[model samples]
Target: MATITVFGATGYAGGHITDEALRRGHEVIAVNRSGSAAAREGVTPVAGSIGDDALVRDLAARSDVLVVAVHGSADGQPYLAALVPNLLKAAAEGGARIGVVGGAGSLKVREGGPRLIDTAGFPEAARTESASHAKVLDALRAADTGADWFYVSPAAEFGAWVPGERTGTYRLGDNVLVTDEHGKSFISGADYAIAFVDEIDEPAHHRARFTVAY
Candidate 1:
Protein backbone atom coordinates (compact mmCIF):
# COMPACT_ATOMS: atom_id res chain seq x y z
CA MET A 1 0.00 0.00 0.00
CA ALA A 2 1.09 3.54 -0.62
CA THR A 3 2.06 6.02 2.05
CA ILE A 4 -0.36 8.90 1.58
CA THR A 5 -0.01 12.29 3.24
CA VAL A 6 -3.26 14.28 3.18
CA PHE A 7 -3.46 17.96 4.05
CA GLY A 8 -6.73 19.25 5.55
CA ALA A 9 -7.44 15.72 6.64
CA THR A 10 -10.06 16.82 9.17
CA GLY A 11 -12.26 18.57 6.65
CA TYR A 12 -15.17 17.04 4.74
CA ALA A 13 -13.42 15.71 1.65
CA GLY A 14 -10.09 15.08 3.36
CA GLY A 15 -11.66 13.24 6.30
CA HIS A 16 -13.43 10.81 4.01
CA ILE A 17 -10.31 10.32 1.90
CA THR A 18 -8.14 9.56 4.94
CA ASP A 19 -10.60 6.96 6.23
CA GLU A 20 -10.88 5.35 2.81
CA ALA A 21 -7.13 5.16 2.40
CA LEU A 22 -6.79 3.52 5.81
CA ARG A 23 -9.55 1.05 4.97
CA ARG A 24 -7.57 0.08 1.91
CA GLY A 25 -4.51 -0.73 4.07
CA HIS A 26 -2.52 2.36 3.12
CA GLU A 27 -0.49 4.27 5.72
CA VAL A 28 -1.89 7.76 6.14
CA ILE A 29 -0.42 10.96 7.53
CA ALA A 30 -3.36 13.18 8.32
CA VAL A 31 -2.32 16.82 8.58
CA ASN A 32 -4.55 19.51 10.01
CA ARG A 33 -4.25 23.02 11.36
CA SER A 34 -5.34 22.05 14.90
CA GLY A 35 -3.07 18.96 15.10
CA SER A 36 -5.90 17.26 16.98
CA ALA A 37 -7.57 15.32 14.22
CA ALA A 38 -9.31 12.20 15.49
CA ALA A 39 -7.12 9.17 15.84
CA ARG A 40 -7.60 6.18 13.61
CA GLU A 41 -5.73 2.98 12.94
CA GLY A 42 -3.06 3.30 10.23
CA VAL A 43 -3.23 7.10 10.53
CA THR A 44 -0.71 9.51 12.03
CA PRO A 45 -2.39 12.85 12.63
CA VAL A 46 -0.09 15.87 12.70
CA ALA A 47 -0.66 19.58 12.90
CA GLY A 48 0.72 21.55 9.96
CA SER A 49 0.34 24.87 8.23
CA ILE A 50 0.04 24.68 4.44
CA GLY A 51 1.93 27.95 4.19
CA ASP A 52 5.06 26.25 5.50
CA ASP A 53 6.95 25.16 2.41
CA ALA A 54 9.60 23.40 4.48
CA LEU A 55 7.03 21.28 6.27
CA VAL A 56 5.34 20.47 2.97
CA ARG A 57 8.62 19.42 1.41
CA ASP A 58 9.50 17.28 4.42
CA LEU A 59 6.18 15.49 4.25
CA ALA A 60 6.45 15.06 0.50
CA ALA A 61 9.88 13.56 0.89
CA ARG A 62 8.42 10.80 3.03
CA SER A 63 5.20 10.16 1.12
CA ASP A 64 4.46 8.23 -2.04
CA VAL A 65 1.62 10.60 -2.76
CA LEU A 66 0.74 14.06 -1.46
CA VAL A 67 -2.99 14.77 -1.40
CA VAL A 68 -4.18 18.37 -1.01
CA ALA A 69 -7.82 18.59 0.08
CA VAL A 70 -7.84 22.14 1.37
CA HIS A 71 -9.77 25.12 0.06
CA GLY A 72 -8.37 27.38 -2.63
CA SER A 73 -9.31 30.53 -0.76
CA ALA A 74 -8.32 31.21 2.85
CA ASP A 75 -9.50 34.20 4.88
CA GLY A 76 -10.86 35.86 1.73
CA GLN A 77 -7.51 35.56 0.00
CA PRO A 78 -6.37 33.33 -2.83
CA TYR A 79 -4.11 30.84 -1.07
CA LEU A 80 -3.48 28.42 -3.94
CA ALA A 81 -1.43 30.95 -5.91
CA ALA A 82 1.53 30.55 -3.58
CA LEU A 83 0.62 27.12 -2.24
CA VAL A 84 0.43 25.42 -5.63
CA PRO A 85 3.90 26.52 -6.61
CA ASN A 86 5.30 25.27 -3.34
CA LEU A 87 3.57 21.93 -3.78
CA LEU A 88 4.89 21.62 -7.32
CA LYS A 89 8.39 22.35 -6.10
CA ALA A 90 8.12 19.90 -3.23
CA ALA A 91 6.78 17.14 -5.43
CA ALA A 92 9.51 17.72 -7.95
CA GLU A 93 12.18 17.56 -5.26
CA GLY A 94 10.80 14.74 -3.09
CA GLY A 95 9.86 12.28 -5.84
CA ALA A 96 6.21 12.21 -4.78
CA ARG A 97 3.09 12.58 -6.90
CA ILE A 98 0.34 15.11 -6.14
CA GLY A 99 -3.42 14.74 -5.96
CA VAL A 100 -5.64 17.78 -5.52
CA VAL A 101 -9.29 17.86 -4.43
CA GLY A 102 -10.70 20.56 -6.64
CA GLY A 103 -14.22 21.99 -7.00
CA ALA A 104 -16.84 21.37 -9.71
CA GLY A 105 -16.88 24.97 -10.74
CA SER A 106 -13.90 24.39 -12.98
CA LEU A 107 -15.71 21.81 -15.06
CA LYS A 108 -17.60 23.10 -18.04
CA VAL A 109 -21.39 22.88 -17.72
CA ARG A 110 -21.40 21.47 -21.25
CA GLU A 111 -18.88 20.72 -23.90
CA GLY A 112 -17.77 24.00 -25.54
CA GLY A 113 -19.75 25.94 -22.94
CA PRO A 114 -18.74 28.20 -20.12
CA ARG A 115 -17.62 26.84 -16.74
CA LEU A 116 -20.27 26.40 -14.07
CA ILE A 117 -18.82 29.26 -12.09
CA ASP A 118 -19.04 31.50 -15.13
CA THR A 119 -22.59 30.50 -15.91
CA ALA A 120 -25.37 32.92 -15.14
CA GLY A 121 -27.21 32.42 -11.82
CA PHE A 122 -24.25 30.66 -10.25
CA PRO A 123 -23.92 31.55 -6.58
CA GLU A 124 -21.99 34.79 -6.13
CA ALA A 125 -20.60 33.75 -2.78
CA ALA A 126 -18.92 30.68 -4.26
CA ARG A 127 -17.52 32.44 -7.32
CA THR A 128 -14.27 33.50 -5.69
CA GLU A 129 -13.48 30.06 -4.34
CA SER A 130 -14.38 28.46 -7.63
CA ALA A 131 -12.27 30.90 -9.57
CA SER A 132 -9.33 30.19 -7.32
CA HIS A 133 -9.70 26.47 -7.86
CA ALA A 134 -10.03 26.95 -11.60
CA LYS A 135 -6.79 28.86 -11.55
CA VAL A 136 -5.09 26.01 -9.70
CA LEU A 137 -6.17 23.59 -12.40
CA ASP A 138 -4.82 25.96 -15.01
CA ALA A 139 -1.51 26.22 -13.20
CA LEU A 140 -1.23 22.49 -12.83
CA ARG A 141 -1.79 22.02 -16.53
CA ALA A 142 0.86 24.57 -17.43
CA ALA A 143 3.55 23.54 -14.94
CA ASP A 144 6.61 21.56 -15.99
CA THR A 145 7.53 19.07 -13.28
CA GLY A 146 8.91 15.56 -12.99
CA ALA A 147 6.21 14.45 -10.55
CA ASP A 148 2.85 13.23 -11.79
CA TRP A 149 -0.30 14.95 -10.52
CA PHE A 150 -4.08 14.81 -10.89
CA TYR A 151 -6.92 17.12 -9.92
CA VAL A 152 -10.41 15.83 -9.06
CA SER A 153 -13.49 18.01 -9.29
CA PRO A 154 -16.55 16.69 -7.53
CA ALA A 155 -20.16 16.89 -8.76
CA ALA A 156 -22.27 19.99 -8.46
CA GLU A 157 -24.30 18.60 -5.56
CA PHE A 158 -21.31 17.42 -3.60
CA GLY A 159 -20.53 18.40 0.04
CA ALA A 160 -21.74 17.75 3.61
CA TRP A 161 -25.23 19.04 3.00
CA VAL A 162 -25.98 16.08 0.75
CA PRO A 163 -23.68 13.46 2.17
CA GLY A 164 -24.93 10.43 0.31
CA GLU A 165 -24.15 6.80 1.08
CA ARG A 166 -20.98 5.00 0.06
CA THR A 167 -22.55 3.23 -2.89
CA GLY A 168 -19.12 2.41 -4.27
CA THR A 169 -20.18 3.57 -7.73
CA TYR A 170 -19.61 6.78 -9.66
CA ARG A 171 -18.89 8.17 -13.11
CA LEU A 172 -15.75 9.87 -14.30
CA GLY A 173 -15.55 12.69 -16.77
CA ASP A 174 -13.08 14.97 -18.47
CA ASN A 175 -13.30 18.75 -18.56
CA VAL A 176 -17.10 18.61 -18.78
CA LEU A 177 -19.46 17.94 -15.89
CA VAL A 178 -21.05 14.55 -15.43
CA THR A 179 -24.76 14.11 -14.82
CA ASP A 180 -27.28 11.29 -14.64
CA GLU A 181 -30.17 10.62 -17.01
CA HIS A 182 -32.37 12.83 -14.90
CA GLY A 183 -29.99 15.73 -15.31
CA LYS A 184 -28.82 15.60 -11.70
CA SER A 185 -25.15 15.73 -10.91
CA PHE A 186 -23.99 14.40 -7.60
CA ILE A 187 -21.79 11.99 -5.66
CA SER A 188 -21.59 11.21 -1.98
CA GLY A 189 -18.54 11.97 0.09
CA ALA A 190 -17.77 8.30 0.57
CA ASP A 191 -18.05 7.55 -3.12
CA TYR A 192 -15.85 10.51 -3.92
CA ALA A 193 -13.32 9.16 -1.45
CA ILE A 194 -13.48 5.85 -3.23
CA ALA A 195 -12.54 7.57 -6.45
CA PHE A 196 -9.76 9.51 -4.75
CA VAL A 197 -8.23 6.48 -3.10
CA ASP A 198 -8.67 4.43 -6.23
CA GLU A 199 -6.59 6.97 -8.09
CA ILE A 200 -3.86 6.63 -5.48
CA ASP A 201 -3.94 2.85 -5.68
CA GLU A 202 -3.82 2.92 -9.46
CA PRO A 203 -2.73 6.11 -11.15
CA ALA A 204 -4.93 7.58 -13.93
CA HIS A 205 -5.41 10.97 -15.49
CA HIS A 206 -1.80 11.73 -14.79
CA ARG A 207 -0.82 15.36 -15.15
CA ALA A 208 -4.47 16.14 -15.87
CA ARG A 209 -7.84 16.88 -14.22
CA PHE A 210 -10.95 14.69 -13.99
CA THR A 211 -14.41 14.97 -12.49
CA VAL A 212 -16.59 12.52 -10.52
CA ALA A 213 -20.36 12.19 -10.27
CA TYR A 214 -23.24 9.74 -9.97
Candidate 2:
Protein backbone atom coordinates (compact mmCIF):
# COMPACT_ATOMS: atom_id res chain seq x y z
CA MET A 1 0.00 0.00 0.00
CA ALA A 2 1.09 3.58 -0.63
CA THR A 3 2.39 5.60 2.27
CA ILE A 4 0.25 8.74 2.47
CA THR A 5 1.07 11.90 4.38
CA VAL A 6 -2.02 13.95 5.21
CA PHE A 7 -2.01 17.48 6.56
CA GLY A 8 -4.91 18.61 8.76
CA ALA A 9 -5.37 15.04 9.78
CA THR A 10 -7.31 16.02 12.89
CA GLY A 11 -9.92 17.88 10.89
CA TYR A 12 -13.15 16.43 9.58
CA ALA A 13 -12.23 15.54 6.03
CA GLY A 14 -8.66 14.65 6.84
CA GLY A 15 -9.68 12.47 9.75
CA HIS A 16 -11.98 10.42 7.60
CA ILE A 17 -9.42 10.22 4.80
CA THR A 18 -6.74 9.09 7.23
CA ASP A 19 -9.02 6.44 8.65
CA GLU A 20 -9.91 5.20 5.21
CA ALA A 21 -6.28 4.99 4.23
CA LEU A 22 -5.58 2.94 7.33
CA ARG A 23 -8.56 0.76 6.58
CA ARG A 24 -7.02 -0.03 3.20
CA GLY A 25 -3.72 -1.00 4.83
CA HIS A 26 -1.95 2.14 3.71
CA GLU A 27 0.44 3.75 6.20
CA VAL A 28 -0.50 7.30 7.21
CA ILE A 29 1.52 10.23 8.50
CA ALA A 30 -1.13 12.33 10.21
CA VAL A 31 -0.02 15.94 10.57
CA ASN A 32 -1.86 18.41 12.76
CA ARG A 33 -1.23 21.43 14.95
CA SER A 34 -1.21 19.40 18.11
CA GLY A 35 -0.13 16.05 16.67
CA SER A 36 -2.85 14.56 18.83
CA ALA A 37 -4.79 12.72 16.19
CA ALA A 38 -6.48 9.72 17.72
CA ALA A 39 -4.09 6.89 18.50
CA ARG A 40 -4.64 4.24 15.89
CA GLU A 41 -2.77 1.53 14.09
CA GLY A 42 -0.97 2.44 10.89
CA VAL A 43 -0.97 6.14 11.79
CA THR A 44 2.04 8.20 12.74
CA PRO A 45 0.82 11.47 14.22
CA VAL A 46 3.05 14.45 13.55
CA ALA A 47 2.79 17.81 15.23
CA GLY A 48 3.54 20.28 12.50
CA SER A 49 2.28 23.16 10.40
CA ILE A 50 2.00 23.26 6.63
CA GLY A 51 3.98 26.47 6.75
CA ASP A 52 7.03 24.53 7.82
CA ASP A 53 8.79 23.97 4.55
CA ALA A 54 11.40 21.71 6.14
CA LEU A 55 8.77 19.48 7.70
CA VAL A 56 6.62 19.39 4.60
CA ARG A 57 9.53 18.49 2.39
CA ASP A 58 10.70 15.85 4.82
CA LEU A 59 7.30 14.22 4.98
CA ALA A 60 6.72 14.54 1.26
CA ALA A 61 10.06 12.93 0.65
CA ARG A 62 9.22 10.02 2.88
CA SER A 63 5.84 9.19 1.43
CA ASP A 64 4.47 8.14 -1.93
CA VAL A 65 1.71 10.75 -1.76
CA LEU A 66 1.05 14.02 0.04
CA VAL A 67 -2.56 14.92 0.81
CA VAL A 68 -3.44 18.52 1.62
CA ALA A 69 -6.70 18.66 3.53
CA VAL A 70 -6.15 22.09 5.02
CA HIS A 71 -7.68 25.52 4.47
CA GLY A 72 -6.41 28.78 2.96
CA SER A 73 -5.28 30.17 6.25
CA ALA A 74 -3.01 29.01 9.06
CA ASP A 75 -2.32 30.81 12.30
CA GLY A 76 -4.61 33.64 11.08
CA GLN A 77 -2.38 34.28 8.09
CA PRO A 78 -2.90 33.43 4.44
CA TYR A 79 -1.13 30.11 3.77
CA LEU A 80 -2.07 28.92 0.28
CA ALA A 81 0.24 31.48 -1.28
CA ALA A 82 3.22 29.54 0.00
CA LEU A 83 1.62 26.13 0.33
CA VAL A 84 1.36 25.39 -3.39
CA PRO A 85 4.88 26.45 -4.13
CA ASN A 86 6.21 24.44 -1.24
CA LEU A 87 4.20 21.38 -2.23
CA LEU A 88 5.35 21.60 -5.84
CA LYS A 89 8.96 21.73 -4.78
CA ALA A 90 8.53 18.96 -2.28
CA ALA A 91 6.65 16.75 -4.69
CA ALA A 92 9.36 17.21 -7.27
CA GLU A 93 12.08 16.50 -4.76
CA GLY A 94 10.33 13.41 -3.38
CA GLY A 95 8.73 12.17 -6.56
CA ALA A 96 5.44 11.97 -4.74
CA ARG A 97 2.03 12.91 -6.08
CA ILE A 98 -0.07 15.62 -4.41
CA GLY A 99 -3.76 15.35 -3.62
CA VAL A 100 -5.69 18.39 -2.46
CA VAL A 101 -9.07 18.67 -0.81
CA GLY A 102 -10.47 21.61 -2.71
CA GLY A 103 -13.58 23.75 -2.35
CA ALA A 104 -16.67 23.52 -4.56
CA GLY A 105 -16.70 27.24 -5.30
CA SER A 106 -14.58 26.76 -8.38
CA LEU A 107 -17.00 24.27 -9.90
CA LYS A 108 -19.35 25.63 -12.54
CA VAL A 109 -23.08 25.77 -11.83
CA ARG A 110 -23.52 24.23 -15.28
CA GLU A 111 -21.47 23.41 -18.29
CA GLY A 112 -19.93 26.59 -19.77
CA GLY A 113 -21.62 28.66 -17.08
CA PRO A 114 -20.30 30.96 -14.36
CA ARG A 115 -18.64 29.40 -11.31
CA LEU A 116 -20.78 28.67 -8.28
CA ILE A 117 -18.91 31.29 -6.27
CA ASP A 118 -19.90 33.97 -8.76
CA THR A 119 -23.55 32.99 -8.86
CA ALA A 120 -26.20 35.02 -7.08
CA GLY A 121 -27.20 34.05 -3.51
CA PHE A 122 -23.86 32.44 -2.80
CA PRO A 123 -23.01 32.76 0.89
CA GLU A 124 -21.17 36.03 1.48
CA ALA A 125 -19.37 34.56 4.47
CA ALA A 126 -17.78 31.84 2.36
CA ARG A 127 -16.92 34.10 -0.55
CA THR A 128 -13.37 34.82 0.56
CA GLU A 129 -12.54 31.21 1.46
CA SER A 130 -14.09 29.89 -1.73
CA ALA A 131 -12.26 32.40 -3.85
CA SER A 132 -9.01 31.45 -2.17
CA HIS A 133 -9.60 27.78 -2.97
CA ALA A 134 -10.33 28.67 -6.58
CA LYS A 135 -6.95 30.31 -6.63
CA VAL A 136 -5.41 27.06 -5.36
CA LEU A 137 -6.84 25.28 -8.40
CA ASP A 138 -5.39 27.92 -10.66
CA ALA A 139 -2.03 27.62 -8.98
CA LEU A 140 -1.96 23.88 -9.51
CA ARG A 141 -2.84 24.26 -13.18
CA ALA A 142 0.04 26.67 -13.60
CA ALA A 143 2.50 24.53 -11.68
CA ASP A 144 5.56 23.10 -13.39
CA THR A 145 5.14 19.96 -15.50
CA GLY A 146 7.08 17.90 -12.97
CA ALA A 147 4.51 18.64 -10.31
CA ASP A 148 1.88 15.86 -10.28
CA TRP A 149 -1.32 16.81 -8.50
CA PHE A 150 -5.10 16.27 -8.41
CA TYR A 151 -7.80 18.27 -6.69
CA VAL A 152 -11.16 17.06 -5.38
CA SER A 153 -14.00 19.51 -4.81
CA PRO A 154 -16.84 18.20 -2.73
CA ALA A 155 -20.54 18.90 -3.29
CA ALA A 156 -21.95 22.26 -2.18
CA GLU A 157 -23.68 20.85 0.89
CA PHE A 158 -20.57 19.23 2.33
CA GLY A 159 -18.96 19.87 5.77
CA ALA A 160 -19.12 18.78 9.39
CA TRP A 161 -22.53 20.32 9.94
CA VAL A 162 -24.15 17.51 7.99
CA PRO A 163 -22.44 14.27 8.93
CA GLY A 164 -24.51 12.08 6.68
CA GLU A 165 -23.95 8.33 6.63
CA ARG A 166 -21.87 6.68 3.96
CA THR A 167 -23.90 4.90 1.28
CA GLY A 168 -20.85 3.44 -0.49
CA THR A 169 -21.88 5.34 -3.58
CA TYR A 170 -21.35 8.80 -5.12
CA ARG A 171 -21.46 10.70 -8.37
CA LEU A 172 -18.28 12.12 -9.84
CA GLY A 173 -17.90 15.01 -12.25
CA ASP A 174 -15.37 17.24 -13.87
CA ASN A 175 -15.24 20.98 -13.16
CA VAL A 176 -19.01 21.10 -12.92
CA LEU A 177 -21.03 20.50 -9.77
CA VAL A 178 -22.88 17.18 -9.41
CA THR A 179 -26.50 17.38 -8.36
CA ASP A 180 -29.35 14.95 -7.82
CA GLU A 181 -32.70 14.79 -9.61
CA HIS A 182 -34.07 17.42 -7.23
CA GLY A 183 -31.15 19.78 -7.89
CA LYS A 184 -29.51 19.09 -4.54
CA SER A 185 -25.78 18.43 -4.39
CA PHE A 186 -24.34 16.51 -1.47
CA ILE A 187 -21.92 13.76 -0.37
CA SER A 188 -21.25 12.40 3.05
CA GLY A 189 -17.75 12.74 4.45
CA ALA A 190 -17.20 8.99 4.46
CA ASP A 191 -18.06 8.60 0.79
CA TYR A 192 -15.84 11.49 -0.12
CA ALA A 193 -12.92 9.71 1.58
CA ILE A 194 -13.70 6.61 -0.44
CA ALA A 195 -13.38 8.57 -3.66
CA PHE A 196 -10.22 10.28 -2.49
CA VAL A 197 -8.51 7.07 -1.40
CA ASP A 198 -9.68 5.27 -4.53
CA GLU A 199 -7.79 7.85 -6.53
CA ILE A 200 -4.71 7.30 -4.40
CA ASP A 201 -4.99 3.57 -5.07
CA GLU A 202 -5.43 4.03 -8.81
CA PRO A 203 -4.23 7.22 -10.43
CA ALA A 204 -6.74 9.12 -12.60
CA HIS A 205 -7.45 12.73 -13.52
CA HIS A 206 -3.81 13.61 -13.18
CA ARG A 207 -3.20 17.35 -12.83
CA ALA A 208 -6.96 17.87 -13.00
CA ARG A 209 -9.82 18.76 -10.66
CA PHE A 210 -12.83 16.51 -10.04
CA THR A 211 -16.04 16.90 -8.02
CA VAL A 212 -18.02 14.43 -5.89
CA ALA A 213 -21.68 14.44 -4.93
CA TYR A 214 -24.72 12.30 -4.32
Candidate 3:
Protein backbone atom coordinates (compact mmCIF):
# COMPACT_ATOMS: atom_id res chain seq x y z
CA MET A 1 0.00 0.00 0.00
CA ALA A 2 1.14 3.54 -0.71
CA THR A 3 1.87 6.04 2.03
CA ILE A 4 -0.16 9.10 1.08
CA THR A 5 0.17 12.45 2.84
CA VAL A 6 -2.68 14.89 2.35
CA PHE A 7 -1.95 18.49 3.29
CA GLY A 8 -5.52 19.75 3.34
CA ALA A 9 -7.09 16.69 4.88
CA THR A 10 -9.89 18.66 6.51
CA GLY A 11 -10.91 20.62 3.42
CA TYR A 12 -13.62 19.51 1.02
CA ALA A 13 -11.52 17.90 -1.72
CA GLY A 14 -8.77 16.86 0.65
CA GLY A 15 -11.25 15.23 3.02
CA HIS A 16 -12.68 13.21 0.19
CA ILE A 17 -9.23 12.20 -1.00
CA THR A 18 -8.21 11.15 2.49
CA ASP A 19 -11.30 9.03 2.89
CA GLU A 20 -10.93 7.55 -0.55
CA ALA A 21 -7.32 6.65 0.12
CA LEU A 22 -8.24 4.95 3.37
CA ARG A 23 -11.14 3.13 1.73
CA ARG A 24 -8.60 1.65 -0.69
CA GLY A 25 -6.53 0.50 2.33
CA HIS A 26 -3.69 2.96 1.87
CA GLU A 27 -1.91 4.57 4.79
CA VAL A 28 -2.94 8.22 5.15
CA ILE A 29 -1.29 11.04 7.08
CA ALA A 30 -3.96 13.70 7.18
CA VAL A 31 -2.52 17.15 7.87
CA ASN A 32 -4.79 19.87 9.12
CA ARG A 33 -4.63 23.12 11.05
CA SER A 34 -5.43 21.78 14.52
CA GLY A 35 -3.69 18.91 16.24
CA SER A 36 -7.03 17.93 17.75
CA ALA A 37 -8.58 17.46 14.34
CA ALA A 38 -10.61 14.32 13.81
CA ALA A 39 -10.08 13.40 10.19
CA ARG A 40 -11.52 9.94 9.69
CA GLU A 41 -11.10 6.30 10.51
CA GLY A 42 -7.72 4.81 9.63
CA VAL A 43 -6.27 8.27 9.07
CA THR A 44 -3.41 9.67 11.10
CA PRO A 45 -4.23 13.34 11.52
CA VAL A 46 -1.30 15.74 11.88
CA ALA A 47 -2.06 19.34 12.69
CA GLY A 48 0.16 21.82 10.90
CA SER A 49 0.29 24.60 8.36
CA ILE A 50 1.68 24.37 4.83
CA GLY A 51 3.91 27.37 5.46
CA ASP A 52 6.35 25.35 7.53
CA ASP A 53 9.05 24.10 5.22
CA ALA A 54 10.55 21.66 7.68
CA LEU A 55 7.18 20.17 8.52
CA VAL A 56 6.36 19.70 4.85
CA ARG A 57 9.72 18.13 4.09
CA ASP A 58 9.47 15.73 7.00
CA LEU A 59 6.01 14.62 5.95
CA ALA A 60 7.06 14.17 2.35
CA ALA A 61 10.13 12.21 3.39
CA ARG A 62 7.93 9.40 4.68
CA SER A 63 5.28 9.55 1.98
CA ASP A 64 5.21 7.98 -1.45
CA VAL A 65 2.66 10.49 -2.67
CA LEU A 66 1.92 14.04 -1.49
CA VAL A 67 -1.40 15.66 -2.28
CA VAL A 68 -1.82 19.44 -1.93
CA ALA A 69 -5.50 20.35 -1.69
CA VAL A 70 -5.10 23.37 0.53
CA HIS A 71 -5.97 27.00 0.01
CA GLY A 72 -4.75 30.10 1.83
CA SER A 73 -5.56 31.51 5.24
CA ALA A 74 -9.14 31.98 6.48
CA ASP A 75 -8.85 35.69 5.70
CA GLY A 76 -8.81 34.92 1.96
CA GLN A 77 -5.10 35.24 1.26
CA PRO A 78 -3.75 33.86 -2.00
CA TYR A 79 -0.98 31.54 -0.90
CA LEU A 80 -1.45 28.59 -3.20
CA ALA A 81 1.05 29.85 -5.72
CA ALA A 82 3.59 30.34 -2.96
CA LEU A 83 2.94 27.07 -1.16
CA VAL A 84 3.09 24.93 -4.31
CA PRO A 85 6.66 25.84 -5.11
CA ASN A 86 7.66 25.06 -1.56
CA LEU A 87 5.77 21.78 -1.77
CA LEU A 88 7.52 20.98 -5.01
CA LYS A 89 10.85 21.63 -3.37
CA ALA A 90 9.97 19.36 -0.48
CA ALA A 91 8.72 16.63 -2.78
CA ALA A 92 11.92 16.76 -4.73
CA GLU A 93 13.94 16.49 -1.55
CA GLY A 94 11.91 13.47 -0.41
CA GLY A 95 11.68 11.92 -3.86
CA ALA A 96 7.91 11.73 -3.61
CA ARG A 97 5.40 12.42 -6.33
CA ILE A 98 3.25 15.51 -5.87
CA GLY A 99 -0.28 16.15 -7.06
CA VAL A 100 -2.05 19.48 -6.71
CA VAL A 101 -5.77 20.20 -6.98
CA GLY A 102 -5.80 22.95 -9.57
CA GLY A 103 -8.55 25.15 -10.98
CA ALA A 104 -10.53 25.31 -14.23
CA GLY A 105 -9.61 28.95 -14.71
CA SER A 106 -6.52 27.97 -16.71
CA LEU A 107 -8.47 25.53 -18.86
CA LYS A 108 -9.70 26.56 -22.27
CA VAL A 109 -13.33 26.37 -23.24
CA ARG A 110 -12.46 26.02 -26.89
CA GLU A 111 -9.43 24.56 -28.63
CA GLY A 112 -7.59 27.89 -28.62
CA GLY A 113 -10.08 30.22 -27.09
CA PRO A 114 -9.88 32.08 -23.79
CA ARG A 115 -9.82 30.21 -20.50
CA LEU A 116 -12.98 29.40 -18.62
CA ILE A 117 -12.22 32.12 -16.09
CA ASP A 118 -12.21 34.74 -18.80
CA THR A 119 -15.66 33.68 -19.92
CA ALA A 120 -18.92 35.10 -18.70
CA GLY A 121 -20.42 34.70 -15.20
CA PHE A 122 -17.09 34.11 -13.58
CA PRO A 123 -17.41 35.37 -10.02
CA GLU A 124 -15.60 38.64 -9.40
CA ALA A 125 -14.80 37.70 -5.83
CA ALA A 126 -13.17 34.51 -7.00
CA ARG A 127 -11.00 36.13 -9.64
CA THR A 128 -7.94 36.50 -7.44
CA GLU A 129 -8.03 32.96 -6.13
CA SER A 130 -8.69 31.62 -9.61
CA ALA A 131 -5.75 33.51 -11.02
CA SER A 132 -3.56 32.24 -8.23
CA HIS A 133 -4.48 28.67 -9.03
CA ALA A 134 -3.64 29.21 -12.66
CA LYS A 135 -0.33 30.68 -11.63
CA VAL A 136 0.39 27.57 -9.59
CA LEU A 137 -0.13 25.47 -12.69
CA ASP A 138 2.21 27.69 -14.61
CA ALA A 139 4.88 27.35 -11.94
CA LEU A 140 4.54 23.58 -11.88
CA ARG A 141 4.83 23.35 -15.62
CA ALA A 142 8.05 25.34 -15.57
CA ALA A 143 9.58 23.65 -12.54
CA ASP A 144 12.34 21.08 -12.96
CA THR A 145 11.04 18.70 -10.33
CA GLY A 146 11.79 15.71 -12.56
CA ALA A 147 8.98 13.17 -13.14
CA ASP A 148 7.01 13.37 -9.92
CA TRP A 149 4.80 16.42 -10.24
CA PHE A 150 1.28 16.84 -11.59
CA TYR A 151 -1.69 19.21 -11.38
CA VAL A 152 -5.32 18.21 -11.72
CA SER A 153 -8.02 20.74 -12.52
CA PRO A 154 -11.66 20.01 -11.87
CA ALA A 155 -14.53 20.82 -14.22
CA ALA A 156 -16.01 24.31 -14.41
CA GLU A 157 -19.19 23.37 -12.53
CA PHE A 158 -17.43 21.66 -9.63
CA GLY A 159 -17.87 23.27 -6.20
CA ALA A 160 -19.50 22.92 -2.78
CA TRP A 161 -22.94 23.59 -4.27
CA VAL A 162 -22.88 20.58 -6.57
CA PRO A 163 -22.69 17.63 -4.23
CA GLY A 164 -23.76 14.98 -6.68
CA GLU A 165 -23.74 11.25 -6.06
CA ARG A 166 -20.91 8.97 -6.99
CA THR A 167 -21.51 7.11 -10.21
CA GLY A 168 -17.93 5.82 -10.26
CA THR A 169 -17.51 7.10 -13.78
CA TYR A 170 -15.47 10.04 -15.09
CA ARG A 171 -13.47 11.18 -18.08
CA LEU A 172 -10.05 12.83 -18.13
CA GLY A 173 -9.12 15.85 -20.19
CA ASP A 174 -6.10 18.07 -20.85
CA ASN A 175 -6.40 21.78 -20.08
CA VAL A 176 -9.94 21.81 -21.44
CA LEU A 177 -13.18 22.32 -19.60
CA VAL A 178 -15.01 18.99 -19.54
CA THR A 179 -18.73 19.12 -20.17
CA ASP A 180 -21.46 16.50 -20.45
CA GLU A 181 -23.92 15.91 -23.25
CA HIS A 182 -25.85 19.02 -22.35
CA GLY A 183 -22.69 21.14 -22.10
CA LYS A 184 -22.71 20.95 -18.32
CA SER A 185 -19.34 20.64 -16.64
CA PHE A 186 -19.52 19.11 -13.20
CA ILE A 187 -18.26 16.30 -11.01
CA SER A 188 -19.17 15.08 -7.56
CA GLY A 189 -16.70 15.30 -4.72
CA ALA A 190 -16.88 11.55 -4.20
CA ASP A 191 -16.23 10.89 -7.86
CA TYR A 192 -13.43 13.45 -8.03
CA ALA A 193 -11.80 11.72 -5.07
CA ILE A 194 -12.17 8.45 -6.89
CA ALA A 195 -10.27 9.88 -9.84
CA PHE A 196 -7.56 11.41 -7.64
CA VAL A 197 -6.94 8.17 -5.80
CA ASP A 198 -7.07 6.25 -9.05
CA GLU A 199 -4.20 8.38 -10.30
CA ILE A 200 -2.31 7.55 -7.14
CA ASP A 201 -2.74 3.84 -7.87
CA GLU A 202 -1.78 4.20 -11.49
CA PRO A 203 0.82 6.86 -12.28
CA ALA A 204 -0.36 8.35 -15.51
CA HIS A 205 0.09 11.91 -16.81
CA HIS A 206 3.19 12.85 -14.91
CA ARG A 207 4.87 16.28 -14.89
CA ALA A 208 1.66 17.67 -16.36
CA ARG A 209 -1.92 18.64 -15.58
CA PHE A 210 -5.19 16.88 -16.29
CA THR A 211 -8.91 17.36 -15.69
CA VAL A 212 -11.69 15.08 -14.50
CA ALA A 213 -15.42 15.45 -15.03
CA TYR A 214 -18.58 13.47 -15.58
Candidate 2 residue-wise lDDT, 1-214, digit = tens = 8999999998889988998899899999999989998778899999999879999889988999999999975454456855798889989898999999999999999999999999999998888788888888898998776878999999999999987998889989999999999999999999999999999999888999999999
List TM-scores for all candidates, in order. Answer: 0.98, 0.97, 0.94
Cα displacement (angstroms), candidate 3, residue 139, comes to 0.8
Off by over 4 Å in 3: 39-41, 72-77
Among these predictions, the greatest TM-score belongs to 1
Model 2 segments more than 4 A misplaced = 74-77
Quantify how close model 2 is to the true structure by its C-alpha RMSD in Å: 1.2
C-alpha lDDT of all candidate models, in order: 0.91, 0.90, 0.85
Candidate order (TM-score): 1, 2, 3
- When sorted by lDDT, best at the front, the candidate numbers are 1, 2, 3
Candidate 2 lDDT for residue 180: 99
Q: Which of the two candidates, 1 or 3, achieves a greater lDDT against the reference?
A: 1
lDDT of 1 by residue, 54-107 (tens): 899999999999999999988877788567877999998999999999999989
* Residue-wise C-alpha lDDT for candidate 3, range 51-120, written one tens digit per residue: 8899999988999999989763236666777677788888888989998888888899979889988999
Q: Which candidate is the best by lDDT?
A: 1
lDDT of 3: 0.85
List the pairs of residues colliding in candidate 2: none
